[model samples]
Target: LPATVTIDQPAVLTASAAGDDVTCYNAANGTITVSSPTGGSGEFEFRINGGTWQEGLVFSNLAPDTYTIDIRDKNNPLCIVTLPETVTIDQPAVLSASAAGDDVTCFNAANGKITVSSPTGGSGEYEFRINGGTWQEGLVFSNLAPDTYTIDIRDKNTPACIVTLPGTVTIDQPAVLSASAAGDDVTCYNAANGKITVSSPTGGSGEYEFRINGGT
Candidate 1:
């Protein structure tokens, strides 16, 4: 007498993946997570870009790029389930910002302005800010207080690509003017020998002028 036997094979391996892009400019925090895995031999292990296999279903700390994810059965190592769509991790564009500005002419003038050169190395219209204040579309910032400031620029296409310009904005003003005067008393009244001299005029751009009788 002969006995009949039957064999069973695991279903075809299949899976799907979802991913997230880097939150900040040039960041490496992108992630890819495997989900909806089906038709494998046993408990699943996952890997990306053919890296070492692990039981974890999520791959994190990945840079911005395209990736291939593979899911395999722990029971049958040869059965590898590839997600239908490859994972694509992306990041905000790298933004390079630089700026130069005009210093306030006088103390407390508050009329200083910043001129941000058309930003390079990023996409879309640029927005500007001062010291991380509210964002705006204008490149020139006017009526700024007399102090050191930083320009915050962002890409309209990618808000996450914000950058503080490398060059610091210094809206400054010269200190108020101060001076002392000395006069020589003439031996004779209204003598032509009488002389008044202004000494060591400090502050106010180091330039000074004396007005006799308040005359310009």
Candidate 2:
């Protein structure tokens, strides 16, 4: 005599997720990589988008895209595991800009200045360029005229990501004002007998003020 009876079958569910793409433009650090959510029958829950179902499977920060990964089997809630394949996290406008300079205190100065130092990544309301010209939200590039300069920065909410500090702002002047003069000629009408003399006044930085025709 032999007799036995037992048969139970309900175990086959698979769902997967893997994504990480967000290094700029609205960077929220994007990340998602669910670990265990396979096979049906009792205790298993992880949520995203619809929210609230935490069992933790790594899904941090996450911004700039679409995502939906819900797996439920708390004890057969229809034993769902729908993740057909659709999880994107993308952001690429890439931007990183920098520039700083202030030199030319004399000797042929336009008061030299080049400043635009607050640009990193996209989604910023920043736009400034000099040399390649015209695109200013004003980050100070006043007067400026002395040499090497190429500054460029863009992120007017991602304007094709243009960032170039190339020549790296270098404006210098002050050492080109040497004088040596002497003259004396009288007898026409004696306007102080016309005498002019200025000796050894080299370079330029401070103390040097003299005029003749403009009289001073």
Q: Per-candidate RMSD vs. true structure?
A: 5.4, 8.7
Best by TM-score: 1
Per-residue accuracy of model 2 over 1-216 as CA lDDT, tens digit each: 498887976676666888887656676888988765667774677777777776677888888788888888777766666677778998876676677888888778788898877676666577888888788888888888798888778777556556675556789998988789999887688456777799988777756877878876
> Which residue pairs show backbone clashes in model 2?
none
Task: Write one digit per residue (lDDT tens) for candidate 1, span 144-180.
Answer: 8788888887887667777777768788788988788
Separately for all candidates shown, the number of backbone clashes (residues 3 or more apart, or on different chains) is 0, 0
What's the alpha carbon RMSD for model 2? Answer: 8.7
State candidate 2's TM-score.
0.46
Give the clashing pairs for model 1: none
TM-scores of the candidates in the order shown: 0.62, 0.46
